[model samples]
Target: MATATIPGPRMPRAMQTLGWTSRPLPFVERAHAAFGDVFRIKIGRDTFVVLADPADVKQVFTGDPAVYHAGEANIILLPFLGHKSVLLLDDAAHLSQRKLLLPPFHGGKMRRHVGLMREIAEREIAGWPTGVPFAVQPRMQALTLEVIMRIVFGVDEGDPRLARLRTRLTHFLETTATPREMRRLLVNGPIRAERRRIFASLLDPVDAVIAEVIADHRRRDDLADRDDVLSMLLLARHDDGSPMDDAELRDELVTLLVAGHETTATALAWAVERLTRHRAALERLTEEARAGGEEYVDAVIRETLRLRPVLPFVGRRLTQPQTIGGIAMPAGTKVAPSIHLVHRRGDLYPEPMAFRPERWLGVRTNPYTFLPFGGGVRRCLGASFAETELRAVLGVLVSQVRLAPSQPANEHVGRRVITLVPDRGGEVVATRVAPDVAMPSAA
Candidate 1:
């Protein structure tokens, strides 16, 4: 029997899974067209009551944490993120970890990292091949990874340790993102215990390096003097005056590493992809970049994230029978707020399909309507850090080089694990480079 009372596609679950894996946006859009704002989707053994309306989304985000278990809904990520990860914790545990993790990502701290971001971005942007079509996503990935390595991991660029970990992690992440691996994950959507063990074994190499890093941090006498996230975390004390253990640090560090870099890189790739297609926005952003004004640059990033959100949905599993959108759902039913759907609603955004940065200029968008980072208490912890990275990278990129789309059409979305990435990896051709831009210095 169908677990959901809401109307949705009556297709065989296999067909629904195929559509979701291959063409998520279209699949959701088709359902929304046929079934209006709220719909049901059955994937594997779970039934997700997907919510598209902002009002309904608001209710879910603002709902009592005990009832709407975000962490329980994110259990599939447990193996990759570890059992102690803030992403895998709920209620008080999640809140306590959130408080500890909050300081380093605060607004002032993010600003301190902008110079490093611009330097890394400038160095990477300088090396982009000119007058030839090439995918920018890989380069963006490299750039963001380096940023996370330095700013979050506290690893210096030239260190042998950084090179080793970076190489291993890049391979690990890319391997997991392959179509074969993605399909395997989809088939193992429930992430059974054996599958989790397999996932953990795969992380053994990366975990070895993280263990080394944690040991190094402990040995450092100047931990309190360092501004990097890892250092602050080492020095942070719980409300009970207890320091986080090695296992907790390892889990949190890995969580930040995976979540912090990849998503920002994907967003930057999309920024280049979108800007290259929109001449006016590109020119305005470049001009703003060179003039040291960030208003338009910020707007461009806001619009890009809105249209190409890295993650399509934020999920909360019902802990008890609860009514949402006036429809009751049983315990363990997943209610997903569709970020992709709400961003495209015509009622909320005129010409939502069109890329329009000007729409955000000098406007304070309603939190529910413009939640690219998700909303309420469960909003992404790295939200500000990601935005800061984007602004710095995009600003540095546009100021240094001129980019144009290699293909006439915009790049189509492709699935990468849980993220939606550019199908062609955001292919583009750099036409011009500023002579002043310098290659990365070994310093």
Candidate 2:
């Protein structure tokens, strides 16, 4: 059995209460300072072991899959994502699902989508008049939704159902991230009358759409090799020659669509805000993008990912008793590698918060020290796809528009559901830098 060692000063009830309330960052920061790299905190019945140490993070994240499972950590998402969703699967199931989904996001496949990404980004930015204040999050979300719709469903933005689905899906994700609602649900069971009302409002429409898509696919008996993700999923068969059932297909599709677009959109919006706040970094990014090299643009994207990880924490449940940083944690305890905190560790990143793209130019940091898409078998399947789209989209944005934040810098960080979104919705004034460039393709 693992032994427990209390580290530093015990957390005051005030700080513990704050962890259960609205602001978690302050409690997290306080814990880091008082307890060094690792510590344990209790929020109601959940005891979360937070680790910001690089070695421990790597061990917990990339260690044996059977021992550290994400399915246990992400239980909250299961109701919406379904039991078979990749996020909730582990071991062989995760491996098998990952293999089936790999082809769509492979290097060759991702390169083909660059032109498509560039086109959507350019077209979206063109719609914003010079000096007009606009919300960047919604715009990015729309553009990403369009791209994902085309790739996943092989449908154009003009499809009436697409618009409705986007609206409903966005509302659902936003509702799940509400601090007050989330706290209530965490403390109480999800069966509460109010929680059910909100969840039903968002989920009903999505289920309808998923059912419609499945019905459409079933009607087509002449299904042959097709380019979209749906087609790939349809054609996939297990090693035993059993195909995925309709329920499984629906869960996987919804998971990919939501996970693929939402996080990338949030990351892109945050990247824009960061660039607007730091003029030096923005100028360097602009210059590098204009110069046109894979390495330079990649640097900017990497630095942005490092600074503001889309999914800030990768959670796992300890299957075996373990000690981290001299703190003993028992089996079934919740362990999270605080990616945001780890990325900001002064030891791993010099002047961590400063937006310096040059850090990634030639310098080598520990792989575990910078995990934007996570690590190990459960790593994000859409990571390659997201990177390709982000770099391509940002490349086009920088080349054509100069974006300035419309709100104060300090107020930029806001909470949208679980996502650390821009408080002002990333409101910005965008002016077209080059009118001569043909509007980017929307397909």
Candidate 3:
């Protein structure tokens, strides 16, 4: 019946803050090395109780969602995700919204987007600065955004509205999701208000565009046969036969837009960067794909996600008093399952630092240990959609494009929002393979 203090660095708060913001991976690795599985670290005004052990991670992820409120811990994302966004809801509300949204991104429903993904990737990659070095992350972002707008929103590819909306979205995402912005929002009052004002101004047009799209969908009778997510969402009814309202629909659309695109873009960039560096893996993936199979491609993606998890941490906050990792967690305490550290644990992964896709051959990975998509109730709703996109994009690119790192040095990890991005934006030169060997024309 006693609360035990979590052990961590005795270093000054300033140093901890510095390490967390500037270089999170090394900061976490050092903390876990010094304090073992569970430790405490401060970022801005928050104190995070970090856990890397699989047992602790399972408890945090699989525990009652009522007790561990993912929504509360993600308050920073609320402005971007919107007031009614499913990502910011808890318990019953969260469950209801999730049920409404899951069908479009699940099983067979999600596989329907593969052709869209392949088409987007092919068109975008066709224009890559071939025979010259360029950052592939921007290209990847463009490709994923196009897929989201077309496949998720039902937007026409060449529509002027689509272009205008993309500009606004990129501006909103770039302006808001940064470490400086997060810290300022946490602690700075005046700046935060100014930011809120600017953010509202930026968001208004984007909201308007989404509303127009939803309205247009309502007017159109030809959509019942459509496979796009927006169409499905428009037609979807709850258990009691209620459909999402205009605001709810728009918020969820924005949620899918932001959440669906950037994370996959970052993951794809890392996959390319990793594959180009590891020749054997690259060869195996290419050969496997050429043989009319994607088993090795799946392995490559699995390895990429494990090595460079898009979100460095999966966060949750306690709603009531509970014990985690044998340490007392009072209500309102923040906890982060360190995805970065757990993926690199020597026990879970042999040669944890190396990029070896074969490690997955005939291997069964525990979901808690290999959680790039997270676990349980709050796991990413678009997990299957994202995986399918990655596989489609990777299969196409690996077969048609011959690519390698622009510089001899390895790409360093960089932070954007909460995702780890490739340094210099996964810089590489892409060239076409021989005509006979070019990726089979996008289906």
Candidate 4:
């Protein structure tokens, strides 16, 4: 006989609607506090189990891919990323697609491109004016976009259309992901109409650029020169020896562009904020970077991901009946493992909220506990690439520039789209740190 399902409190319908279409972190935090590790919340007639327990997160993430596929979790991204993108694949298809794209993000390949990342960062940082109050989010976004365009698409940094595409896409993402904006879109039909108009305005340039790349690849007689991710995908063959169609190629390109750039930008921006707030940590990072190479800087980056993960929660649907945390879960149920809550568990992390890079220096936490990039078969494809870019950009920034928060410490920053972003854009007063002088230790 099956175990009886554990009944949990449900979020009120109005609150559920508000939470679903608006920022839901406060409500989620309250539920976790009330119900312990696991709780249920109703969103638009569907019951989603929000789980923060590390054990339960491990079970759902590492047990069986079929039982908890990400396809159902990523429905919101489908209209933007499309079906063929690796973000939406599952089972065998997921595995195959991941294999095809794995080379560019592999350790060796990423190491080879570290110079490119550093070069881009140096170029961008050189342009910042002294003692200027600049929005770190937009500048970081632009820098990451340039890195992605060069490495992933092999597009020149001087391309005009690329700049326009980035602006349009950024605007679209900011508007669509805002809690208040999403609520309007969900409740008012006309909001979607306006969104469609904006989306159409943006897609034209993106399509033209991608189409040109596809045509160029098709016309090339010798494929040896094609070495970027785009080129690799162009040359890759399926089991039946069939090449990817233009439509498939377009989806993959867009996926890499959007997913590749946005999350890293968010992570970098948060790292800047954290480093600014903690003076000792920032100074230590700079000293370590100067003395050695990227090890300490890497730890700082990893710890940042642990604390304020770019994507706070990832969803998976239960395709088979399973029991987690002694509660029975049926098929078609959505289970969310929150990185925000999991990384802050006192048992797992002694000072869960403290910004300490030393924790990552010698100790290695379980993969499931430190899952900013997730784990198992469905782990993020660009994980290695992201780390490389982050290390390079952060190392450069911390060593060359000092960042001070423009806003007060008590200000409430919130989530936007697939990332944790500040509500007013993370404003920072940046000044170029002299190369010879040491930065004061973070207090």
Candidate 5:
């Protein structure tokens, strides 16, 4: 069979690289407009065949795990997340790590962290300056970072260790997410020696703190009684009955930090950004938040994620030749389901760019059509947990105060490494604060 030639922009690779790194949404929109549902585009050394059709997305998501190498497609993350990180693992290694990490984020186990999430949200919400504009993304980052530290690292409030690690990690993420650094990342890829050394300088101290926390947890007698993820992981045994070693534990912990922290924060920031611009939706969500029901709040989150998915695409590099949507792809081709484009397709969503939570009410969205988190076996293990945290945080936020856009126009999307975020950091003003909201005790 002849492989169909996938059409794309005939522009130089340098222009494609710039567009991808700095302004992905426009880049993708232009490509999809010019080349239809499937097209090829190069970023750094890899050529991604971007697919916006749900059927093609379903194929990549449900494709044979051996032939669809998600980890290889995500190799750029390895320098920060480490080789043993599940995000960087494939096949049996990926399955094993995923199994060990699953129990901690299981439904009942995850709900245990909600009260803490709300408390953190309340603490942060209380500090926002009233009647003044501020970037909510940084505040959201602080809130989510604290949640990850407390929940995943088992370091609770007032822990000096938490304070130190938080400072270091925030700076590290900020530095890496800057445009200059991101451009460098796009140019050099993940394994260049100087880049690795620079990353080592940032990651080493964070790793040191993680190592300390791991050792301290091992020596504690209350390990079995604790509900935090690190404690649960410590108690977990592999299928072979061996406990995970220090390196493995460290890698997984960092993976959770990288995977959970900014991604959830960016989602929350976008939620605030979207709600502030749409008055009726904001009013309805505020009422829902105060009255205490999951239905509408859940829809609001779904809609926010749909319109502003953190990562624009989820990729799987072909390890063996395969056909998708009638096009024969050779091995080494990265098949990326364009999450941003799929979510915006008018066929799948009417008035696709509008923020409408009502669209999700009483609606069962097809998983492939509405995957803010990537689909199938490689789907984010923390999906439920992230959603749970979003609900808790947003609930506390709306109940405590009302937000309005700082500027008349909406903020443009910005690239923070691999995640899409509000360019102006979701600038919003606290227009009103509900008086004397009752504080729930910590769980």
Candidate 6:
């Protein structure tokens, strides 16, 4: 039998929404502290059952994506990601789309893009102003955005349309970075008209740019030999030999542009923030970088994801009867596998708050215990790509220039709609100081 209710804070709806919007991480931690590993939190009209235990997290991740329905769990994002997107699809359709998409992101295709990524990262890092504090997020965003535009959309660097699309998409993101904009779209009422008006205005030109790119790809004969992701997607065949329709193509492209770039930019910024404060780790990382420490670089990225996951949690809406951590839950119940809380648990990670890259050097972490990319069928398709991008970007960043924390105290993660962005935009000072020590093992 299903439990009637779970233990959660019984705060008024208004307060819950306010607390969640203002400070999501602290709110979740408080809930875990007060109610233990399993608890519930109601925000607006929805109730989510949150699981902090790694064992419980495994159940949610290992459960079939069809039953868990990751796309449905993120219905609130349809206004941005769209309906035909692989991100919003479930079960068979999701599998079909993944089959077409996976090939381009793996194998020789990924290897071919590795050098392009390094070039892009180096060029962007070269432009940063030295001896002054600047937010790394903007540069990281620009670097990732340009990389995706070229690699994913097949747009050439000199194209005027690429510049326009970048501006328009950035503007769109700015508007959507608040609670007011979210409520304008998610909630229905008299305000729905306003949301539509604004979204249409923001979306029209961006869609036009994407449409133009798609048309160009369709007309090009040379694309058969090209290996850009969009070209690959254009040529990718379904089981019955049909190509994806324009809407499907456009939606998936937009999803990649947004979903692919945003999380990575935020994560890179967080990495810089963490490194600045953890001087020892930063020094070791610099030594590794100067000495070409690929393993150490990987460790730094791994530790960054562990310490500050750009997305705080992976949520699923229960489709049928399910139990997690011994508590039975009925259908329609929403479950949030708490990534942030899980990473910070004392039992799982000693000195949970410390930033230590050395810890990951020789440890084989249990998949469920360290779920930065989530797990199971719905795991992030861009996981390997994002990690590759981070390593490439950081390789250019640390090897070429040295950075230090501009702020004495740690910067808090602020609410940015769905993403928890670094507060004060991850401010850091750029210095061209050379690393004095070389890691022989890395060399």
- The TM-score of predicted model 5 comes to 0.95
Model 3 / residue 113 / CA error / Å: 1.2
Worst 10 residues of 5 by lDDT: 434-443
RMSD in order of candidates: 2.5, 3.3, 2.2, 4.2, 2.1, 3.1
| Residue 338 Cα positional deviation in candidate 1, in Å, after optimal superposition | 0.8
What C-alpha root-mean-square deviation, in Å, does candidate 5 show against the real structure? 2.1
What digit string (tens of lDDT, one per residue) describes model 1 on residues 276-309?
A: 8899999898777766788998899889999999
Q: Against the unseen true structure, what C-alpha lDDT does each candidate score?
A: 0.85, 0.74, 0.84, 0.75, 0.87, 0.82
Candidate 4: where is the Cα deviation over 4 Å?
Answer: 1-9, 17-23, 44-46, 157-199, 220-227, 408-411, 435-443
Clashing pairs in 1: none
In each prediction, how many residue pairs overlap at the backbone (N, C-alpha, C within less than 3 A)?
0, 2, 0, 5, 0, 0
Worst 10 residues of 4 by lDDT: 1-10
Q: For residues 1-443, write the lDDT of model 2, one tens digit per residue.
A: 33235442366655575563456565677778988887767655556677888888878866788888887676666657776788777778877777777776676777767776788787787776688788788888888887887777655457677776667767766676667757756665543533455456557787888777667776676556446677777788877888878877878887887688778898888888878887787877777676666676677788888877777678888778777666777877678888888888898888997888878997664668888888777777888889988888888888788888887564435556556676677778887776565233333
TM-score attained by model 6: 0.93
Quote the lDDT for 304 in model 6. Answer: 89
Return the TM-score for candidate 3, rounded to 2 decimals.
0.95
For model 6, the local distance difference test gives 0.82
Which residue pairs does candidate 3 place in steric collision? none
Candidate 6 residue-wise lDDT, 61-83, digit = tens: 88877668787876666766667
Tens-place lDDT digits, model 3, residues 212-317:
8899889889778898888989898878898888888988998998888889999999998998898788888888877768778888989999999999888888
Q: Pick the candidate with the highest lDDT.
A: 5
Candidate 6, number of clashes: 0
TM-score of 2: 0.88
Query: What value does the lDDT take at residue 335 in candidate 4?
Result: 83
Backbone clashes in model 5, listed as residue pairs: none
TM-score of candidate 4 relative to the true fold: 0.88
- At residue 420, candidate 1 shows an lDDT of 90
Instruction: Output the worst ten-in-a-row residue range by lDDT, candidate 3.
Output: 189-198
- Model 3 clashes, total count: 0
